[model samples]
Target: MPTTPISPPPIDRTGRWLASLTQWVLAHKRLVAVAWLVLTLAGFYGSAKVTGALDENFTMPNSASTVTNERIVSRFDSGGGTPPLVAVVTLPPGTTASAPAVRADLRALEQDLARAVPGARIASFGSTSEPAYVSDDGRTTFAVLHPPSSVVGDNGPSGSEIDEETVARAAQAAADARVGGAEVRLTGNALLTSEAAGESGPAFLSETLLAGVGALIVLVFVFASALALVPLLMAIVSIPVTLLAVWGLTALTEVNIVVVFLVSLIGLGVAIDYALLVVMRWREERERGLSNEQAIVHAAGTAGRAVLFSGTTVAIGLLAALVLPVPFLRSMGIGGLLIPLASVAVALTLLPVVLATVGPFADARRLRRTDRAERHWAAWARLVIRHRIAATLAGAALLVALCVAAQGILLGSPEARSLGGTGAPKAALQQLERSGIGAAPLAPVEVLTPADRAADTAARLAAVDGVRAASAPEGAWRADGQAVVEVLTRSDTNSQAGRATIGALRDAAATLPATTIGGSTAQTIDFVDAVYGSFPLMLALISIVTFVLLARAFRSIVLPAKAIAMNLLSVFATWGVMTLVWQHGVGTELLFGVGPDGAVQAWAPVIVFAFIYGLSMDYEVFILARMREEYDRTGSTDEAVVRGMAGTGRLVTSAALIVFLAFASMATAGDRDLQVLATGLAAGVLLDALVVRSLLVPATVSWLGRWNWWMPERGRRLLRLPAVTPATES
Candidate 1:
């Protein structure tokens, strides 16, 4: 037999560290196991605090609206950040509000509402005696409910508005109005935000359970033994630990309520994935005939190294959120970042100990077995390697087509029409609008100035484009020698036209000293600018940091670069799918029980991007790291690609499916933003695993051949990596 070429020792510091960690974990298996259990118990104890601290309100600090609200709070002790809830009171056809019978009914209705929700200060035609509160047609009028600022706590004024129970009750109280042959209905920023957030808690719970069940099933298929339970156990432990860490974070800063859903759903997927990668590697090492201890060490050196780098990539992708300048988004980033880091910690330490103690029992039963080479994946990989250019071009063409479809996406806050037509609020708003009384500005723009300038400022604003009306009623709102003028727009304040109008008014107000514009519309402009203004920098930071870390892991220059490039393509493709489904309304109505809005929700894109970038890398690292390992042993690019696929193909697909299920469950919340987010993540995982990771990546690597592993001698030395000659065609 020909002598085998001697393989060089691993010079990678990361790998050595991982190997050392595995040894320590294995040596103290019992102690590590007990410590993890205690940590998990602590997490359960802290989860309630995290839950209580979450707030859904979106705020842009130092924005026009924020400054205006602060001034109102400090001076008038009112009009902080409360969006007015509109109670549409419409008389029966042929009836008018002036009718004595109608007036009596209106008064009773007002009393009923006050009795129903005592805390929100109720302002209506019955309570205020203001002609403007009623429609010019005399058949319709409205009441405005102001949510108390104190209930919002220290997070901010907007926080009170998103309290699902509070808003739902307000809407219900309005819907229950039945006096004076008139029907009462509620539709406003407060109600709309409530409807979206109301279902999040139950939906998140459902998604977590669904994902858990799905993961167990997938693990069974992959392992075909009790060993499938190993990852699940790790997930149970890791999820709680991550939650506990997030809870501690909340004590020091504002955390978004949305982060709870993200941590639970996304965290579940990531935890199991880390465990799966480690378990699969351990199994492979065992099959190679190494002792249990030696196998754990070798698996840790290879798969553990990948998990460490992959976790960093996942965390780095989420770090982009910290650049957005919104505390809620930043909290989401922090919450998301914790999942991978916590999972990595568990995987490197607790996981090996479990493998050393409980893993053998689970692995003992093997109803289905893996061979030295997984025949199906090997054949498919060989097929792609042989026809590499065609595979690469086909995948690229599909991605390009998807990107083109995404180009027409519209982005804005949801319109009344987009909130769906089934709710009581929807029915009321629609009825009022048909009679030419559109949903009035529930969140009116506030123009603040000296008391003397109030009338002049109001008159000037009334003349501006898109202003339906402006008023500075005497004694209406005054404090600290300052006056407040309310300006109503022709469009719903959160709509695109409304935001455009707000921008123009801001430009006009520049000439007026000490006059500030504040409302939902003005805040939308600031929120978008603050987040997107810094996105390019965030993208660069994530990509650069990830590339360096991945390069160190693979010990090659080309692999990490190619991996990053492919991930961007996948992300764009995902956005295309989101745009098509949500913005374009391709299949939303029939599938999700909601009609397509013309625009995606304001905050969905950045959150989705941050999560998708990291999640996509999770699968990318798992597959490519295995390929890198194979290439070092075989020194043949084609063989390495084929064998790596054979080894990791099922595991990657299973992991992707698990994550997809987790995100897909979010659609069940019956909220448009949740649906869009679910669609983006679910579609991204499918395309990434099936198209990018499965086809494009392998084909690209095969076409590049030995060049895929190339590094200059100087570069190799700088990174302190082992020497390797590039392999030529056999």
Candidate 2:
């Protein structure tokens, strides 16, 4: 049969090498199963005692920030100057946002809060903070509540505290506060982020589990074996054990649960995901009458190499996150690094051993009726093949349009209303707001300059364009030899205006030769800066590694380029959708829960993009591999592209579905901000899986024709990549 060039698989693929290795590993699946069972028992039992929903953003670099938060926490430990928060208060009709009744009500509300909250020694609130109340326009007013903390060293409760009664009061007060005219709204970090995390966290769990199971089910169905679940189970072992390890390690180091979760999910998903590919390929080798050990050796050599490339590509891509200055990025990088490393370990060690032990499980689902989805995917492939160029161009065009939209997206600071799930802390914020002291929404931008430079920096800031009202002097803070400067935001403090103030202050301080800004807002600006600057490095990492891996995998440079292009395209499209829904506020009001007034959080885009890029690459690899397999067999690029599309489409779609479901589940939580984020992710995943991968990727690959695989022939030798080898197993 004359073979033609295949663009790449329209379907997602784990590649031939992965399939073969999985087959070889299945030989000793029983031993792998037993080992996993024991490990699960030991790990789960150990962590069971402390198992519960933690309110803190699992990603915070608690080590560094904890000290600062603790200091602030300790000051009011006995409760003195700090005010009682009253949120969810009613305001009189026809009164402006800053009207007297609203202002008086704020004071009354603060007093009411002091009287209502039983545990405090002292509390205060009034109309003075009113400018910040109702958000300057007076639509939202909140009195500050300084919850009295336990005396120093007394452990004044973990933020919202796990106690039931306290939680109940917080809730009841919020609900009852909407009396006399105002509808109360409660929000605060403790409540907001907790709720946000609650919504997104479980969805993540569900996505991981479902993806793992879905992959397993596919394997069993493909092999007509009931035991296909074993290998997948082997992969699941990595997630929980890894998470606990991540938790304990984070207590000592800087990693967080998000890192742990992502790594574990990727490790489990990709590991098991790749493991299946390796196993399937190895099985083909076995069916060819190769001896068990030879098949294992062949699988390892061939599928193993592909697994190595895929894992290495993914690991390298994610590790780029480390270059970022923030803890979240570092956590992502380190976690990403760990997952693949772990995956490699299992694939080479436990996987190989298990496959040898439980090859019988491979046949368990062989006789089951073929899953309908696979057939549907096959039909899709034929249609794509029949109209390759037009299909491809159409797909490419769509992705490009989406990509453009994604680029236009914006972000804002997350607010209490945005935080949907974490309830108790939110109640506190609400209580504070209802009290009518403004600044509830203010993320204080604290600045400290050398005492010598303080006045000048303060003066420059005082005179700077956006200074709503610079305090008589820089407010007092405890930075040594540094005068603290607090600049009330003038509209754009959280927008370009806010960024500009930060820049001007920074620039002015730089000119002073001794001034600097350091506070939550300042830190946020810095963090955003760090993330923005490092994003290129992250993209470069993915691109370079992808280029290398693709070239090697296909023995051609062009294939990798096409794959990466598609992956990026998926990201762009996802972003465009997010920008429209989350940013422009044209139609996003209802989905995210809070009023669409707040801008998107500045940090969400980088983080979200990071996730989108990495996961899309996962799909790209799967598709490319399938196409590669077909190309290798028939030597026809076009035919191979179609066949590969048919082969891997169902799996990729299912994988996307699981991921989508995981993210969307977050929307159900209490925090509105998180709900929006979850919605964005869910939408992105759906588009990526069904639209980009299924339709666009296939069509584009078809249209690109041979050019999709067109690499500069002479350039391949320049990278000095390892000599590619066909799998020994099959």
Candidate 3:
């Protein structure tokens, strides 16, 4: 078909730049396509040769937990006592608490556990050691098993001691318990860890596979052409290569699987997502007036730059997690930095080549859908613009309210045995209460005094407000010249009082003895310290990076600031939901079946912040790219906001759904931690898609009016920032 020639057409700078860019792309199609194919194959082959880097705690080197594991290892090497485990002896509910059968059964369990797991010594007894470790009632009994260092390394404790192949021989000495006709149960750090791993594994595999297939289906439904899926098909091949490369690097370095897998997920997800975004726009460009070559270049230069800007901001934000002064977080930061770069490279190279070869088939139907002006998205944008003030206020208020609830969150405690009333820890705790020690929660405090003043230090520690008892064992291997004090409290250890208890113990021991606390309680305190302290720094880094990058992308300082603020607000809102559902016991029974005891997961806040910040910026690019494009033509912020939000809303929602589905599937894993994480992430992304991107953003943009285009003088002079190409107003 012959195209109409332009005569005295509009002389717009943005359009002229796009036209020049298209001419440049058309001139080099063959070379670019060939190079893209070569790179894609190479990336795939490399990943295939590399292994899958998983967070296999048992196999993971000591580097994952350097600080904590190093101390435990040194202590064990010095002949310090081993870590303790819990063994539960169950009896019928109606049975007498002090029955002879119960006592005999408890003794038999001790022997059986020792035989089953060799070197498993009894750390404490319910009757003789203390009552706090067990329950006050007599129906439950606890045998704390402390395995010797010979079998399990302190750095990475062995979860599978008796292998399946050797279990028969090991089981020969194991006592088949029938205590008072109730089945005996044993569960603690070891058992729970084992179960959580098993659950996360299969679910991770299944969800990954299902998500890949679902993403493909969404592409097909959206584009309605197999050729449209070519970009994604390249991604499908590239992800494995990326994953293997990550794994291979890990064997030689400290790079953990979290970086590899998460990056792969986001990389493939975003690469495919970006590919879809550009391909459709390419089709639209062709349909408008340009040849295939001109159209592909226009898509790449415009949408390409948008994706590039978005990817960098996200990468930097995630990378900042490493700056938290923590190791695990550092690894995650590295992973964040690498994966997005890989995704961007693929989108730039692979997608362009695929489009070069199959651009014609993309819009083969040549049938444009009608009623676009009255589409769901256009109506939504109008509603938001009409109610900009009200909608923006509501959104802001919602985030503030949720953040207020989060202020009440307490540190989590995994030490006590009386959580939900169905385990060994509780039984042992109940026994301790009966013995007059378990009534109140306490933080354990161990103090090492100079030999000359050991007795004097112990006497001083005993007088601390929360110190229930202080034992200064002379010449004991557990504490060499140390006074190990048991500090009891009137409040739970996870509470404010409990945190105060730990600080108090340290202060009391500072002058008397050099002290340390090593227990489940100690681990909780350490976690709280690392997470809370790092949160502010994390927020600052993310806010700065996002603001700088987005500002550079649009040459608009105010717009970028808005984007970062909106992103943080989304994360805050998610945190609020978590606090209500997890910390405040609002949805505990319905969601997890157990009433929440203290705070959400120790790492939840950080994880939410990282994911939300990275993903929210995705929409920022989609909307802003179109806004920038429209600004070039109309020079009207309100027009750009409506046009941009409407034009890309469908694609944005599809991308959000892909991420949401992938995360939500984790809820099926059944582990409490996994379930909570999946919920928080999915909720955040969902809100970003509907509430933030769809409603809040356009409303705010409408209110900002002309100021939305304001940019720092420095950005304007660089010219590296792409000039906005404004199309004629619809």
Candidate 4:
């Protein structure tokens, strides 16, 4: 019989398209590189100016608290929206707050503060002469200064109108003028935040530099060549381009201040990650004896495609935030969505061009052998496959335990003690606590009422179960046919009892007409309800969309389901770790010099969930895509699992470490919310790479065998993907 040569399989549409695009990039290497350089320069400028545009507005539209706040701010110039800056004055031991000279000094101090801070409304022992303004011992009196409200469209008040430094200086000078020695200290949400952030918190640039250094170290260990620097360069280019996009976004809508940190840090990690995947795969192809151009195309057809899928999943995860009613979070989603897409663009377009020109030259000066890393990973994969059931069970058990710990997570503001500051703000708060005033003054409930019924409403609110006292102060509290009643709770509003007190007050106010509650605690409660109430729907939408995308990428129904399940477990595990470390104060004191906060900041969990779910999916896509390739090439599921792990295990591990280091750098921030977010993301990356991807995924794939590659006809038709035939059937 004459020899009949077998033909190679035809290239799929996606692979063919990637190969052509890679060729085109290689042809115009210089032009692509120059384009990215121009965008990067613009990005540097955008990043610098973007911060000024960010606003921390947490208002929920159409919510009861939001409606009440708008009306109050409109009617009374100072009552509802802005948190008051409290100035505490303690007279000498012999001089009571009621002393003639002391009252005169307090009145003078209030007038000075009003003069110093334009649009400020002051209420104190001098302004109202209410007994509630004085401490039990009658030596301490505090004045509440409500800063001016300037609501700019839907973004709420543009922060505090009065400057903290100005308030402090004026109050101090007036108190010093008193005949009896008197001391003044300022304490409030704004002042405490500034004090806690004093010089220790890292800026976006410094944090990016720190993360870059950490990533450099990991890259050197992995590549052991001048090529280790290539990914960093790609990141340098990717970050600024993403920021430029964000800058453009700012022109259209409001972007959250937090987006700056996320773009710098998360953008750095993701850009470098995509570059690392493509570069490593190209190097592997070259080592296998492909020509330079051939290697680039092959890498693009495989690893480049994986990067596309990964970036899309990340974008999808962040897009889930758009479902939220809160404007800032939705803006965060839009900002975060730009990050991965920009990175993918750089990796796919700019990266291949750079590699085609200088890759071989840069990779030649190797400090260590590359094969050693692969051999170690291969050996580990074999061991895992040998005990597949045990590996699966162990990984599941560990993740389950972490999920249990997450059950204790409470979503609210941190307690007063948890606020970071060792300066004047801390001392003032402590002094107020010692004076038997406690945090009640810090979080008073403001009720907007009909002017005629003000006193009656105050009396009715005072009898509420958790009400400590209620006062309808005269001057600033009454305006425009409406009166403001300030109600003090027995406990701090962030506390459980305080939350209960707010609920009781709301219920009691429900029976009263044209009466509504508006204050910090009420606003916070509305925020929590608005964000979390829709969370289940958001989760379902993300899950469904992600499942469909993964199914099309993997061409396997079972595999996508498994990947989604694993990613969810990874997210919950990360949350559990955050709960223990931050909420329960496990190692928090030793690490951050702060004690247990008893609750995670209300915004941290949702942001963490969005980032982790998508980032974790990246690993799943990387590993399984390679496994699918190996399965198609070979005729055994065992061989596919082993080969897949051996190929992608090291790459996934290195990428995870790079990302974790980037997020970990955020812990240096003085803000507790950022620290919590950083902890959750860093922990999630490690847990996913080490546990979920390493052991559980390979073990489960191996155990599932032929079934792992099966896709139903209906799914194939819906996805417009070819039916997957298992190696065993072939």
- The model with the greater TM-score, 3 or 4, is 4
TM-score, prediction 3: 0.80
Worst 10 residues of 4 by lDDT: 1-10
Let me know the TM-score candidate 4 reaches against the reference structure.
0.92
Quote the lDDT for 436 in model 2.
42
Lowest lDDT 10-mer window, candidate 2? 151-160
- The lowest-lDDT stretch of 10 consecutive residues in candidate 1 is 1-10
- lDDT by residue (tens digit), candidate 4, 285-373: 89999777788888888888899989999999999999999888898999999999999999899989888789999998899798887
Candidate 3 — which residues are off by over 4 angstroms? 1-72, 77-83, 88-112, 126-141, 149-185, 192-203, 365-374, 411-497, 585-597, 712-730
Model 2 earns a TM-score of: 0.71
Candidate scoring better on TM-score of 2 and 3: 3
- Which pairs, if any, clash in model 4? none
Task: Show where candidate 1 strays beyond 4 Å.
Answer: 1-11, 53-57, 73-80, 89-143, 151-184, 192-206, 371-373, 421-424, 669-673
Ranking under TM-score, best-scoring first?
4, 1, 3, 2
Give candidate 3's total backbone clashes.
Answer: 19
lDDT per residue for candidate 2 within 1-730, as digits (tens), equals 2112212212124334444445534555666667766766665653342124222342223332233333443432421111122354434555554655555655565555556565432211243441433444445445434355541121111122223344345545655654336765544444444354333334455555665665666565555675466557556665555555555555565554345345545555566656665676567567778765556655665556556666677677667777776665566566566566556656665766666656646553466554465567878887877876776677677768877876665554543344444444555455444444323233434454565665566557766665553431322232356444445555434455666766776665567655545434444454556567677887887688778767766666667776777777777677677676766665664554444434566655665666666667667777776676666676566677777876677657655655564455445543444455565667667777776777766776666566655545466567553443432212
Which candidate leads the pack in TM-score?
A: 4
- Name the candidate, 1 or 3, with the larger TM-score value: 1
What lDDT would candidate 1 get against the real structure?
0.76
TM-score of each: 0.88, 0.71, 0.80, 0.92
Which is the better candidate, 2 or 4, if ranked by lDDT? 4
Indicate the residue-level lDDT of 662 in model 2.
49
Q: Using lDDT as the measure, which candidate wins?
A: 4
